[model samples]
Target: MNNAWTDFLARQGTLPARTAEGATVAVPLTQLGLIRSRGEDSAPFLHNLLSNDINKLAADAAELNSFNTPKGRMLASLLIWREADGHLLALSADILPALLKKLSMYVLRSKVKLSDASAELALAGVAGPRTAELLAAAGLPVPAAPRRHAPAGEGRVIRLGDETFIVALPPDALPAAFEALAAAGAQPAGTDAWMLATIRAGLPLVTAATQEAFVAQMLNYELIGGVSFQKGCYPGQEIVARTQYLGKVKKRMFRVHIDAAEAPAPGADLYAPAFEEQSVGQLVNVAAAPQGGFEALAVLRTSSREAGKVHVGAPDGPALRFLDLPYALP
Candidate 1:
């Protein structure tokens, strides 16, 4: 990361207040780190390792993919997109260093080369009602649909949703680009708000604390296009495929509202009445809601979710209020 860009964001004051509905804000996504893969073997190398089908990735699009353990547990969840030279992956920053090292261990004779690109590239999230207008005014391409990316100034403009866009550009270009959008009525939203938007969108972000705690299906990877049933064998592919084909996926991630006084952290145990003393769920991602509680994602037994209330932290702790996910689940 660039110290200049980091310094500029440090002066942006406190975290912006936001709700599940989101706001018209421009945010520096400091939580995510970028990784670059360039070489003839980049696609094939990644195709053999990740949950998503890399072979089918389109030039103008991005896909939710994961690096999983041999047991089908996720080590890292990434948003993979294309670039002129090769591919770029955006994942939780806390896990990037270790993930990069682990991936390198597998690059025996592969032509692909991986490097941390966070210093050179920066990610700025433009969200809310004015997202499109602000992008166009900033001289960025406004993608027509979600999951599609378009080349812009020095990086790429990715449209995540109707009200959300992420611009990945050169670190040197971020300050100017951000200023132009803010001048056009985009509030300087901090990572807190950006995180809320992600939780509400039902996008599961696997962080360091929650790594390998659940399988790909438990996080609803399959439901949200993070997994490809048709893709060839990856680490733990057999278990993942068996879970799918045998119809044995019982636990799935769900969105919820927790009215606790303090915010919950990832990997926190959840309980349900029917499950008794057993932990029926675990918090996956959490962000403070603009309201007096937290908006979060949790992986829970489908049976527990339907039985009754699920509480966070303890069996008798604060109850979690369920929320609707942007997409439907089967």
Candidate 2:
């Protein structure tokens, strides 16, 4: 463990104690342009619009799901947290504006108010086991086991032990929180670390180029508990359910280990030996590997993935080797 944070994480058993400095960053969610949902019909309204069962998400619990167009295209991938009065939708900082505009069109008669709250809150993340202890030591409320999240000091926090929590901190309080956490020994890892951690954790994030490119199944949402086929209709539920029962999922998300120092941009087209002209898949996220090179998550045709020869950054970019994902596909 090179950094104090890494040393603390080693104590908690999160692998690869120290990888890089700037591993974490406190970004403003509202400033990132996230949309908010508040009002009496918020849950039901969202329930009807997204891929997952919004009603099933218990208070303080967080879930990963997507908002898809009627044509089975994922418009935005979100990490949602149910607050006391409404729901907080956390999305990629890059896609916040477009996400807001896309989801806003459906707000018609619904009582929900969709506005960007990213500016009002701070978003922070960590990677490694020591993250839990760091949270506890910082006097922040840590999520009770793995895959749990809670409101800590007016922020929505999720426990991604291999990665840090995606905490929604109050804007004005962010500087103080960052100072405190740094003083307590948390290094500021960049998005690279968090993205790689997410890929390793089997977490998929959606972006512009890949929007509406995949259904929940294609993204392996079922495998990660992001979808409930039994849950009643959400937007495109018919297609989502049919794909599971009647249709075989030809495409799905895959984790790959590549020996490249440069991280590919999200939504970058992925070419495979099987696919000649059309792209076989798209990159969801990438991160620096613990040992060396890089690791990333991508959605691709299962057949192509199984056949191997995955490459990115070129028609003949660096070749990628498949890695076992932390989770199993359905």
The segments of candidate 1 whose C-alpha lies over 4 angstroms from its true place after superposition are 17-22
TM-score per model over all chains: 0.96, 0.85
Candidate 2 minimal-lDDT segment of 10 residues = 24-33
Per-residue alpha-carbon lDDT of candidate 1 for residues 77-113, written as tens digits (9 for 90 to 100): 9999987767999999999999999999989999999
List model 2 lDDT by residue over 1-330, tens digit each: 023333333343433322654344332222133567998889988888887788878875777778877766777787787878788887766677777787788889988888877656656665565676666666777787555787777776776544457666666565556556666777654455666667778888776656777888888887787777777777777888888889999888888877876767777788887776578888877777767777888888888877888788665888878989887776
Report the number of the highest-lDDT candidate: 1
Report residue 244 deviation for candidate 1 (angstroms): 0.6
TM-score, cand. 1: 0.96
Q: Output the lDDT of residue 54, model 2.
A: 88
